[model samples]
Target: MSENVAPTASAPRSLHGWSTEFRATFTLAWPLVIAQVAQNALQASDVIMMGWLGPEALAAGALASSFLMPFFLFAAGVVGAVAPLTAQARGARDIKAIRRIVRQGFWAAILLAALLLPVVLQIRTVFSWIGQDPALAARAEEYIQIAVLMLFPALGVIVLRSFLSSFEATRVILVVTIGGVVVNAFGNYLLMFGNFGMPRLELRGAGIVIVLTNIFMLAAMLAYVLRHRRFRRFNVLIRFWKPDWPRFRELFHIGVPMGLTVLAEVGLFTAATMLMGRLGTDEVAAHAIALQCASLAFMVPLGLGVAATVRVGIAYGRQDREGVRKAGWTSFALGTGFMAVSALCFLLFGPAIVTIFLDPGVPENRHALALAASFLAIAGIFQLVDGAQVVAAHSLRGLSDTKIPMLMAIFGYWLVGLPIAYVMGFVFDWRGVGIWTGLACGLAFVAVLLVGRFAMRERLGLLDRIRL
Candidate 1:
């Protein structure tokens, strides 16, 4: 891509300016934060609904989610490469480059969907091979079969989201996502329980609602992009079918590892879920509830990381090293600072939080409830490392420094984390709590490496080619 010299005179610089930087980052980050929470709320609602059908249904939903989410997140991560790339282009004032990046992003999302959706569709077979309960696998398969259709629409939304996020026009994303959650809740109510004479579809109804909600979100996003005056000039869809292989290859060049980085961490969790499945139904069910709570807490830092990608990306494009430094550290502070509060909440309120997913009044729910509360207490410690690692990884992504971070994820999650989990949970007989603590240790390791890597960006040559 080509760069045009753009001034960053108005941006905050000195230590005194850190307050201004913090304000600006928070201003951009809040909307993105709410949008992330809204999206997670969509899944959390499904988990809550699944709980209504009892522990078996909830465990099955957990298994189905454990299988499908890593695939979806991997695809979304690939599409997310568009954010930093587009932000850099925008900072350089390369309008043509911005258009091409968004176009190829759409291309990448479509192609990835075609390739990955089929893998998720075989959830039952995969679960069976992995020694999951055949009965649970059958139930989970029904949900996967219907919900898997949303894969394309969901990936498409990420492309549009990246396009919108680069310009900081993220209010629409938050608004639309909250709207989608409302629609999903209503759909779950009507479809799941046979309300208003509808057939009681149970898990299938949750899957059906998820598909419709995603389709609705995609359609709504497309409409806003098409209708909005700010975006019309770019003509993101002007020539949708034309091949831009160079940009496409560049997309994968940057995106594939980004996708796998997501896969590595989430795959660790997925593997952990499989291990939980081997323990018993109560373990799996409790893991699902506690995991859902942890995921929801994660949205804030995840959103802040997205903002950091944009801010740092723009600075990189402008060849402003000091700006990059400020952006990275400001975001890092915000992410970890917030998580400290979250960790306290998780520690203080584990039992209360667990009850939101399943009824504590029910006799069968008590054992899982106790286990989930203990697991959640460990997540209190886990939250801090989780926030730090995510923000650090995303900050590196802003530098277009991907491959090493992916390697770091592999090292932390598989080599260090999962092994510890296996030894602690199986060998030590610590079961669920041991598995979670091991995962937290893995996150802590990656957090140290990634943040250290980012801190050494200059020495590492992670800065862009442009000479200031």
Candidate 2:
């Protein structure tokens, strides 16, 4: 295992000037931000290609993705517990604990991938149970059967990526992920279009590309971490087969709620997708385009949220109250500020953006294209809150405080958001637009509760529980 090493001088501190804090946060954040975009691009590239196969392919891709993601994100969130655990260990300068926590994180990833495999392979059944069109469900099943295999490599990548982020060596993360995006695009082009004598398997081809891209990313990240002088000494694989029962339990302790927290949020969106599906193929496809655009923009805050986890976890481990406060709020401010710009971009350029995903010149796509533009306009409304909620939820995770936030997310998303969506979308006969409005409200609701929880951390003793 790596030895206890003090944070480098460049690490953020409570005593630093405001300008220093901003610079420190930005320096830590920019690579992660780009990496998140590139990570999403792996799928965005697939979406663009699926668009070429026409609306049916695009809608089926969206259906498969929505069905797959709630499970994928839940499992990844469990493995993602590594970031806060490793960061706090880094903060307290505990070499042994960091190695142990990370080892268990890997174990958790492998176990989770195995457990979820059978469940996600049932995508077609779930779609049928939920009353989706038989043809769409069957096409989507073709993608699911292959794409679900990515879970193993994807979760492994998250484990390693969390470790890399803790040490602030994120440039390689950005490089590896961007490389995955490029490779995935190339693979999709060859496999999906029969280029270079390859078979045109369409959605199945896209699924193969997804799995291969994730495996390449996992392999690349592993190679770098193993060879990098700064990380190699950790020897995380030294006892890869040994079981540390307590540490394993601790991973589930923090990870399950984190997983459910992600599930609640993703479930809301997935449910909305189902509702759109009920409305018709064009509704679902348009929802996919607009949602993809919003999700791409969302990668910014999601990156900042990752950075906040490390920064806040470090301070929490050191028992530096002021350090934790500065780190959390600074990240929150930066996230919301960036979203302000994105909101305007969505409002102003939504039609232009939608055009990139679907040709405005196509007669067949005109209705879906117009609907996507309208959905983007609504997506613009929730940008700030969407950004705010992620940063706040992650900041609390840094405190090793997740259970309450999990409940809060459930309340806001399920009890609050889904009910609204049903009423507005179905009861009100508003269809897709009404469904999206509920999503915006749910995000906004979670943002308030989480940020307030952070603001009250001291008063609530949320900051007093550190025992690493």
Candidate 3:
């Protein structure tokens, strides 16, 4: 392991009125934001297209997505470990370490994909237990089954994407993700409604579109990585081989807990959707719209989090403790500010926003819209905290302190968040707003705890341990 590097022996510089460090951080963050936006657009398009199939189809898509999201938690968290490790390697100028981290990430991705297969196969049973409508459950199960089969290729894409992100080569993600979005939209149009002589598979067709687009994205990303001279020089894509047990262990040490943390958080929302179903079809549809909106709004902060991981990892590698601190704070400030503006928009014009996904002319839809707007209003208050937590968690990941954050998220979301939501949504009959309020509380706790952890780590000179 490369550790203990001296900082550059030079004076700090300024960029316009901003510090050079801040400017560099922003430079890294923008591509990530754009990439995230494009990805969100693809997902939103899916929801929008399915909405045209009527409320039941839309609800089925939501159910399918919620069921499948936890699988991504595993893929995402495992692949996510690569960035910090690679960033540290890059900071140390250790090409060998970088290669090792990248290879190990690929191994983890494959293992995770294999592990998820059984779970995906059991998705039908899981949905039944969650109390989905029999008809909706069948549709959701079909979509999820096909989508799950695509996880193998998707895992490869995520690993490669993580490697590029660690090097701050975020533009690669932007290009491929935007391309995927365009492809997904066209595929959805042709398949979902059977346009241009295509068979109309409806919900199942949408799922197929998602799977095909993901495969195309993986191919595009791999082609770019293989053909690009700069990437070729990194030697990340040599011969494929078996897992290196030691390296795999190290990755698993960090990844499994991180994956569980993500699962816990995502699972809470998935469970919320299940709970919403018990209330009625309209309620579930409304919740789906709200969930989609929240997920879209979250992309800004999510991008910032990815950027923070790279910045912090590089700073840690350089043993620049202060630089790590600055990067984390800058990311938090940028992410929170951007999301806050979005929150205000959601609060002030939530009805209009809901109209984008639901038809107000339908009585059921009108009720759903009202409930969705209410949920959005509560969710708005927590957006800043949500952004803060994600960025802070990413910063900590850069420092290789993934475990504590994982514990915090699990306890905060499950022990605190879910129970509160359950009481409010079910026991107290506070309905949707109650569940959202519970979510806010969970997110708030996570934000406070993560920020505190980051600050403590910085104060203790944790970043100095890694040498670049």
lDDT winner among the candidates?
2
TM-score against truth, every candidate: 0.88, 0.88, 0.87
- As for candidate 3, its clashing pairs are 3-467, 4-467, 5-467, 92-468
lDDT of 1 by residue, 285-349 (tens): 99988888888889899999999998888877766667788889999999999999999998999
What is residue 233's positional error in candidate 1, in angstroms? 1.5
How displaced is residue 123 in candidate 3, in Å? 3.0
- Which should have the higher lDDT, number 1 or number 2? 2
* RMSD of model 1 against the true structure: 4.1
Query: Worst ten-residue run, lDDT, model 3?
Result: 9-18
The lDDT for every candidate, in the order shown, is: 0.88, 0.89, 0.81
Where model 3 places Cα greater than 4 Å from the true spot, the runs are 1-18, 48-62, 125-141, 190-208, 277-286, 358-367, 424-429, 459-461, 464-468
Decreasing lDDT order of the candidates: 2, 1, 3
| Model 2, global lDDT | 0.89
Give the runs in model 1 whose Cα sits over 4 Å from its true position: 1-16, 50-62, 131-139, 192-194, 197-205, 276-286, 348-374, 428-431
Q: Which lDDT tens digits does candidate 2 get at residues 1-468?
A: 111223344433355656776787788889999998887778778889999999999999999997888888999989999999999999888988888888898899999999999999998889999899999999999999999999999999999999999988899999999999999999999998889999999999999999999999999999888888888888888889988889899888898999999989878887898899899988998999999888888988998998999998988887666678788999999999999999999999988999898888889999999899889998998999999999999999998889999999999999888988899999999888999999999999999999999988877888655322
lDDT score at residue 193, model 2, on the 0-100 scale: 86
Q: Point out the higher-scoring one by lDDT: 2 or 3.
A: 2
| Clash list (residue pairs), candidate 2 | 2-234
lDDT of 1: 0.88
